[model samples]
Target: MSAAARETPRWLAPAPLWTARTVAAASEEFLRPWIAELRTDSFLADFLSIVGGTDGRSPADLPATLPERSDEDGSYRLFPSHSRRYYLVLASLVCHRPGIPDHTVQPALGERALFVLRRIRQGAEKGFVPSATDTGTWQPATAHALVPGERELPLHRAPVAAFAAPGTAAATLGMAAGQPSARTVRYGYIPVSGGDTVADDVTTTYVIRAVLVRDPCAPVISAPTQPFELAGPLDPDAPRRPSAATTKGPTS
Candidate 1:
């Protein structure tokens, strides 16, 4: 056996019969620092644009941009383009897994996935609601409260038809909820070389956390169950609020 493999505990070695799960104790440990360093509209715009491109959309069609300030309720209002929402959902889903070497899907990231998943679910539910104006543009809004029930969907059972080719085995991903009974499915993709020996294999997994219900009548603001934290090139004590003297619009 290879030295590295021998060094690993027998239980820690990858097994054909086991699916390992990764969990983030706090999602904000990564999110807050990233958000705090976004001190300008240009940064926000560019970030959202990159996020949108991941979903196959032109950034020009995104919604009206917002200032780089978190609202009084501590939520950052990012007006990503209509097409960008899908990317945001996917990005949010994966962000908590910072240093994973490749995109190997696991059952779920546990509590770390909760923060981003909650935000994505809220955005998706809002997208389904009727528009308040006839302008045909969807309103970019945020809810302060956790929408009543969790919006959980089984990862493998949820229809990813929009993202995958017809009849492909994309459904074999992972469970959708955080409960102990959750099950995981793995779908592997292999690339064949001239000799047909497997050149590469990639797998993606998903887990449904919960199915959230919309509560339009609920209060718009509430205390966070957990506060956001900072990581990577950002100082936690740095002023989160932008300088008052800074003017709006692009600054050279």
Candidate 2:
């Protein structure tokens, strides 16, 4: 093996054999803490303020112009800092109904947006379900809370999906100041949104990958999960094949 390949840590084991149920469960596990936090009124209030309110007035240039904490770089910094746990808002997208051309919907970020977290907890025990949107092409109004137009919109809930993975700290990238010299890395997820149709294919399989660096000088170790698929309405004009959404590291 190459020197870098040899440096792969034992903890950086191969991804588990993923099934729809297993994916849902893992997604739920990652989100449970945030979900509990959302259940609290005070937490919801603070989170909404961070996300800006859910007024339903989304910016015309969404995904491109999504807001971020001034102190943060690419991902929006989330709260509960006192606990030393962090959730970062990595990417957000406005998905449209099937048959709608890509241009009509808000453009997607080159980075992977949140996927399947919204429905993981409440969806069927056997599989995944994407969140639903009411309009043909709608921009997400807020990252922190579900908006008014989406079907079955709930109050005090996150509009985007989230998952957990191992990642290097922002300081490593010089995005933050005032850090210990030693490198810091943590397992975290970038919040993304998925609804009716993230893509035009009848079924889309997302290949989730994780990369970790144990030390500043260590070679990065990478792994990929078993293919996880989500069903979507088929667009006759679109190719009849499974589409792939590969995960790169977080936006930053």
Candidate 3:
């Protein structure tokens, strides 16, 4: 069997994972600010120029006057979720494909080693029943770093308060802020699915991926991470590994 064939089918996974709406919402919450900054700093435009896309003209000049919401088409109506996809694609090229014919800039090791966390929900909830084919779509989620010793905190006592602001988190935790080799960091997500329905069995798990973020304000310049099912309680000190599973379900 080929590599693609070796991949697990989505339908075989456990039920009621992270809902699509929740994934979008969570990713947007964490990544939008950085994306907006990327647009403002002209990194996106500069990147486009470096790697010419379907239309082989430099759009490097377009971002200056374009609103934050404008995409490649120069349309003002792009939704946040849709815009993230566009940005992630740009990131994929920058991280994986590296440079084009004449560009000299390259992603640093620190930039290429950032983390993207996708939280998966399990157990039960009340809403429209989903068919086996309802596996969620593949999209990048919020990219962040874990503070030193954060994983040591117990699950219920997770240092969520420290994460109120990325900068504050760094300051309070006494580590180098941003993507630096000196700081040992990781990120996790809290499930938002328990809001509407009450289920005794509801549980949440995080699906994390290794990705490159050229800057805090940039989208992930890498391909989407594959999803995988991790059984049992999360072990904070366990080694990190990549997986390929993104399960979708009803939002509420």
Q: In candidate 1, what are the lDDT values of residues 1-252, reduced to their tens digit?
A: 332322110000001111112122222221221111223435434434432333453212222222233334333333232212101211112211322211222223211112212222222422122334642322323444343333322211111111222222211122112212122211111111112122344211111122112222222121121121111132323443443222121110
Clashes within 3 Å, all models in order:
15, 2, 14
Worst 10 residues of 3 by lDDT: 153-162
Q: Candidate 2, 183: how far from true, in Å? A: 16
Poorest lDDT segment (10 consecutive residues) of candidate 2: 10-19
- Sort all candidates by lDDT, best to worst: 3, 2, 1
Higher-scoring candidate on lDDT, 1 or 2: 2
The residue-level lDDT of candidate 2 at 201 comes to 39
Q: Tell me which residue pairs clash in candidate 2.
A: 113-192, 114-192
| lDDT comparing candidate 1 with the true structure | 0.22
lDDT of 3 by residue, 125-241 (tens): 111222357633323223333322111111110011111123332222222223221111122121222122223565433333334333433323222232212222323233322
Which portions of model 1 show Cα errors greater than 4 Å?
1-73, 78-87, 90-99, 106-149, 153-252
